[model samples]
Target: MVALILILVGCNSGKKGEAAAEQKNPKCKVETSLFGMTPEGDSVMLYTLKNEQDITVTITNYGGIITGIYIPDKNGKTTNITLGFDNLEQYLAGHPNFGALIGRYGNRIANARFSLDGETYTLAANNGNNSLHGGVKGFDDVTWVPEVISCDERAALRLSYLSVDGEEGYPGNLSVTVTYELLMDQLFITYEAECDKATVLNLTNHAYFNLAGEGSIRDHILYI
Candidate 1:
């Protein structure tokens, strides 16, 4: 009847352009390998980014989480600045500080007592008696060790975790490496650590930005 309705509307526009190019290049990704479970038995490890003006960034490895950050504004359109907590029991019942990844001694060791070099340490007051970050099981609640070094290109997936010598009380044998690079437009996070027996380190990354998206972004347009 009209050439089969124009061949069924051009085969439904070529299947909607192959479903929008497989949702802009996502071909199944699910491997957090259980980073200490939470957010419903765990599942968060998806890293995909496109630049050169396409802008997209999705990083996850549990506590290596950046979750998602798509950027491109100034009339090009595409923005997702990063803010979080939608699972893991609301990030273990709230307040590990958004974007997580603040560690060892990110800010406080005061009353947790510290007298390194001569000995005299006692931690885990868990922020009140002192000792935040690395105490109460820091490293954003641990659980890392995901490597994807490369397949030749579009690489960079190395999220490490190795903390010994008194878990959070900090002593030594620490090793941390958090690198999630998606070059071209920039989404480079880098942190390297080393310790053998002289504890106390503070790392940070708690991305809570808002360009006016997600719930309660606080009236956008802030320039802080």
Candidate 2:
């Protein structure tokens, strides 16, 4: 089994944008609601996690996508910093991965194939001759099973999925679980996976952000 964690902390000082909606509940909590239905007739649900600091995040079961991340600025005005579409249709039609979970390989596999255990395996070449982001339908394109977990002073959403052997030509019965937690002023994303056979796996969340909230980030300086 392999475990990986990603963290996003709320900044005390940040850009300006629309104000966040006021919450009726002051304590940390998680709420569920219907987001939409897939073309295949699957029900997609949304999970909203709110913390004591007034930071709220909305995530959807479809693709484990984060629809919004509302954080307050120094002046107490809150706004969403991530870029994503409004409905499932837009996501189904496709956008640049935006706020979605990426896996079992995050980047391209050159020539749409790989050799493991001295045997060559072919993969779907979605990106020209290369297999991009696990090829054709990645983790970002699947619906995940969700469970609510309890944490001291925090709220969390755990999503799990099983990628059967030979999925997308990969040789493994892979069990993947990802957890999104709201602790204080931070949002933590933890990824865990176990494979029955030797295989390749890389996972990450694709979230496009504008720290300034709306304007171009040309003047922004990136650190690492």
Q: Give the per-residue lDDT of model 2 (tens digit) for 47-161.
A: 8888888888888889999988888888888988788878888899988999999988999999989999998999888999999988899999999987765544666787889
Quantify all predictions' global Cα lDDT against the true fold.
0.59, 0.80
RMSD of 1: 17.4
RMSD of each: 17.4, 7.7
Runs in model 2 deviating more than 4 A are 1-26
lDDT of 1 at 198: 77
Write one digit per residue (lDDT tens) for candidate 1, span 116-214: 799988888876888876677778765576664322123345578888888756788888887665544655567788998877687877767776546
Output the number of the TM-score-best candidate.
2
Highest lDDT: give the candidate number. 2
Single out the weakest 10-residue window by summed lDDT for candidate 2: 11-20
Q: Give the TM-score of candidate 1.
A: 0.33
